[model samples]
Target: MTNINTEVVLRKLLDNIAKEHNYNDPNVSVRAITTDGASYSSMLYAATISTPNKEELQLFAKVANVGEIARSQLLLPLFDIERFAYKELLPAYEKIQDRNKLSNKDRLVWPKFYGCNPNLYEETVVLENLKTKGYVAYDRLKSIDWAYASKAVESLAKFHALSIAYGEENPTQYAELLAKMKFNPDSLNKMAGTFDKLVDMAVAVTKEDNKERLRQYILKESGFKNIDKFYQSTGLIILSHGDYKPSNLMHKTNKDGSIDVIPVDYQTISANSPIKDLYYLIFTGSDEEFRRHHYEQLIDHYYQQLCRALRNLNLDPEKHYPKKNYEKDLKDFMPFGLVLGVLALPVITVEAENAPSLQDENGLNSILTTKTSNLYPERLNGIVNDYVRWGIL
Candidate 1:
C-alpha cells in the first residue's frame, strides 16, 4: 500500500477504536505513523496518537494483504480466522480461565485486542504494541535453547488445554467458529502441486539414496492424500494456532535473563488436533539433537501442563483428554510434521535476497522454489534422519 493509503487505514483504525471505546473526542488524532516492514505478508503500522485526555496511545495494527484478498479467491476469507480468534476465541478462553480462578499472572499471555475492522475483505486488527513492552521474536536462523523451548512447550500446552476445557464446556461449540469458515480443497491440491515441484527441485541437490527416499515419501500419490488427511483430521479436535513457528511467537529477556513467551498472528487457527501446532513449532524451530534429547521430555511437559490447565477449568484431564490417547495421537501425527517441513523449511531458510517477492501472484509456488541456502539441505537431511529414527518412513 502507498503512504496515502496507509494513512487512510490508520484513520479508519482510530475511528474503529474510538467507536468501540465510546470516545467522542474531536482532538483525538494520530500524530505519527510508522510501518514495521514490507517484507512480511501483513501491512503492520505503529501509530502514536493523542486520546481525548491528551494521553498518548501507542498501538500496533495488522492490516491483511490487499494482494491476497484480490488475487487468491480462496484465501480472501482467511482473514476472518484471525479476527474471529481475537474477537471471539480469546475472550472465551479468558472466560474459562476466570471461571477456573487463574491468577492474573497465570493467565494466557497475548497482545491485547483493542478492536477490529473486517470490511470488504480488508481485515484490520488493532492490538497492543508489544515491542514497546520489550517483546521480540527469536532469531529464526538459530536453534532455540532448552530454556526457551521448555517455556514454549509449556505455553503451547496452556493454549491447547483451553481447547479441551472449552470443548468440555461447550462440546457442540468447540468447532463452531471453524465450521463457518471455508477451506477450499482446490487450494490444498494447488499446495500439493507446489510441494511436488519443490521436492523435484530438491532431488537434484540431494544425495542419491536420500533423493529417492524424499521423492517416494513426499511425491507419491499418497502425498496428496496425506496432506488432505491432515486437513481433515478432527479427532480430539480443539482450537489451534495453525502457524506456531518462531516468527509467529515473541519473547523477552529480563535483567535476570528470565524469558517471556507471547504469541501473535492468530491467522491459521483451526479446530483440528492440537498436535499440529506443536509439530509445526518443533520441526521449524529446532534441530535433530535438540529433538533427540528433549522431544519426549517436551511432549511430556506439554501433557502435564494440559492436565493442570484442565484441572484449573474444573475438568478431569484423564476423562476429557487422556494421556494414552494424547500420546497415540502425537505418534500417529508425527509424519505430518515431515509433510509440513517440506512446505515450511523452504520458506524458513530462504535468505532475504533469495526469498520470493510477495508481489508474485503464484502463491506458495513463489516461495517454494529452489533456495541458495546450504542450510536448507542440512535442515532437510536432519528432518529425514528424524523420520527414519522414529520409524515414520
Candidate 2:
C-alpha cells in the first residue's frame, strides 16, 4: 500500500526479528490487515515468522502512508514520537519498574516492541500481534460501556504513573523527550479554522435549545483559547497519550470475566496534564448516558489507580499531585471534553462508507468536512446539553 516497497524494508525488519529470536533461516509471510476507516496515516500488515524449530512469532507492522498530500497534512513528528515511545520511552519505563521491583500486575501494559525503522517514506513500527493474543479493537462507532471503560482507564493511569516515575528517575532524559514531543502549534492554528467550521456545522444540526449556547460558547475566541491552553499548560505536567480512544486501544475478555486492555497507538503522545488523557478518553469514547452514570466514579477511579501506581513507584501521590489540586484541574479543564467532542464527533460518527478517503489529497480537511451519520447530532447535543446544564456553556 502506498508503494512502501515492503519486500525491501519489511523483509529486512523481519529478518532482524528472526535473528533476535535466535532463529536460523526462518520463513516469513505477510498479509494486509485491513480495517475500514482505521487509520489515515499508516497501513497495517500482519507478518508471521516461522523458525525451523517449529516456533512462530506473529508480528504487526504499521507502515507510513507516504502520499505527498497525506504526508504534508498529518504531523510528521507524530511518527517520530511513536518510534521514540516504543524504542526508547517504554524500555526506560521498564528499567524504572525493574529497579522498583514492581510486580507484573502493577506494571504498565503494552505490546512488546520488536523494532522500528524511521526512514521518511518507509517509516515502520513492528510489534507483537495483539490479535494473536486474543485482543480485538472495540468498534469505533459504539460507545464504550462501564466494564470496558474501567479496564481502559486503569491502564491509562498506570501509563501516566510510569511517566511520572520515569521523569523523577531521569529528569534530564525526560526533559529531552518532552522537547522532542512538543508539537508545532502552527498545526493547531491551521486546524483552528477547521474547528470553527466544524462547530458551525454542529450548531446547524444540533437541537434548537443547544444551538445558541453551543455556538456562543465555542465560536468565540475564548473557547479556542481554552483548547490552546490545554496544549500549552505548564502545571501538573505528565506524559499524555494524546489520542486515548477506543479505536486506538485493544481489549480482550479473559477467563475470569476480567477485561484486558492495552493502548496500541502512540502517534500523539505528548507532555500535558494527566486529565487531558482522562477527559479525552471519556468524552471521545463514551456517550452521554455512560457519562451520566460513570463520569464522577471514573474520575475517582483514575485518581485512585494513579495513586496506587505512584506508590508502587515509591513516589507519594500527595507530594506529586494532591487530591485537591486534581479536583481544581478537573474543573479548570472541563471545557476540553466539549471542545474535543464537537471537533471529533463528526469524524468519529461518520459511517464507514462515508468516511473520508485516504486517497484524497486534501487529507485532514477531507476528514473535517466528511459526511457524518445521524448519530453525530445526537452525540453533539448530548455533550452540549451536559455543558449547558453544568452552566459552563
Candidate 3:
C-alpha cells in the first residue's frame, strides 16, 4: 500500500496541467488528502502555485481514484459525472440563468468550475477555492442557527428546481443521464449494517425504558427495507445530493449577520428523489419542536422557492412540478427521513470525544466527515421526540 505511487502520478498530472494553464513555476504542495470510507478509492489533494506575490491567486486540486470499489457506491462515483455534468449539463443551466430561474440572486449556486480531467483509472476536478473568502464548513449538530437553516433551505430549492426543469424540458437528456446513474443496493445494505450498530450504541447509552423503545422501533421498521419501497414505487428520482447534511454545507456571514450556504462534496450526486435531500437535512439538523413548528412552513418555503426558480428558467412549475405530485412524493419519502433520523441522530449528536471518530473504521466519519459537533444527543433527542410527537415514528 505504501508503495502506491499516487503522489508521483498526481504531481506529474498537475505539472502538465499547470504548464498548459500558463501557471508560473507552479510548485504544488499537498495540503490534505483522505478517503471517505469504504477503502478502495482515495481523494487526493494538493495546492498549486503558492507564492508571496501571487498569494491572492490560489489553486486547489482534487483527484478521485476509483480502484476497486463497487460501481454502485453513491457519492464517490459522482466525481466521474462531475466532469460530464460540468461540460454538458452545466452549460444548459447557465444559458437559462436569470433572477426568476434561481432562488439566490448571487449566482453562486454551483461551484465555479475551473477544469476536469477524467481518465479510465482516476478523475481530477479543479474548482474555485472558497476558503480564501472566509467560508467555513457548518455542521448543524455542532453549531447551527436559524440563519444557516434558512439559507440552506433556499439553496436546496434552487438546486431541485434546476433539475426538475432540466428533466421536464430535456426529457431525452434526463432519461439518458438517469440511465447512467445506478443505485447500489449492496452499498446501501452495508450502510444499513452501520445504522444497526449505531442503534445498538444509542440503546447502550440510554435508560432501559428508552433503550427498549428505541430498540423496538428499529427492529420493527428502520433500515434499507423501508427505503426500498419508495425506490420500487414511484422511483421519484432526480439529481440528489446522496449525502446531504450540515458538514457538507459551507457557509459565510453577511454584514447584517445573514448566512449564505454553499454545498460541497458533489461526489455522491446521483439520480434519486428530491425528498432524499429534504429528509436527510431535516433529520440530521433540526429537532422535534423545530419540525413541529416549522415542518410545513419549511416544506412550503422549499416548494415555493423551487417553483419560483423553475419559473425563472421559463418553465411552468404548475405543469412540470404540480402540487399534487410534490405532496405524493413528500408523503412517500417522509418515512425515509424519519427512519434515517432515528438511525443518524445518536451518532450525529454526540460530543466529539464521546462520538465515534471519522478515522474509526465503523464511525460516522467513515461515511461523511463533518467537523461540527452541533448534532449532539440533546439536539438529537429533541429531533427524535419531535418525530414521536408528529406520529412519524
TM-score of each: 0.88, 0.94, 0.79
lDDT of 2 by residue, 1-393 (tens): 355675468778888888888878888998887767667677789999997657689999988764666556664367888998898888988898899998887887789999888887778999999999899999988899999998898899899999998889889988987776665566676566677778788789988877787788775633665567777666688889988989999999999999989998998888788898998889888888988889899999999999998999999999999999999889878878878877788887788778776556676778766888898888878888778767787
Report the C-alpha lDDT of model 1 over 252-299, residue by residue, as the tens digit. 888998888987888877667878888888888888888889988887
Per lDDT, what order, best first?
Answer: 2, 1, 3
On lDDT, the stronger of 2 and 3 is 2
Model 1 clash pairs are: none
Instruction: Estimate, for each residue in 1-393, the C-alpha lDDT of model 3 and write its tens digit.
Output: 122355665566666656666667756775664423211244546455543455433545666544333333332465666676667666776655653444447343666666666765446776666766768666434434466776787778777777776787789988987767656455566566656665655565544435566667666665546655544336457787766778678788889887878876666667777777877887777766567777787788878877777777777878877888989988867667646655566555544444333222333334333222444455545655665666755
lDDT of each: 0.71, 0.83, 0.62
Task: For candidate 1, give the lDDT of residue 199.
Answer: 66
The weakest ten consecutive residues by lDDT in model 3 span 33-42
Candidate number with the higher TM-score (1 or 2): 2
In candidate 1, which residue ranges exceed 4 Å CA deviation?
A: 1-4, 15-40, 51-54, 66-76, 181-186, 220-222, 369-372
RMSD (Å) of each candidate, 1 decimal = 3.3, 2.1, 4.6
Clashes of each: 0, 0, 17
Question: Measured by TM-score, how close is model 3 to the native structure?
Answer: 0.79
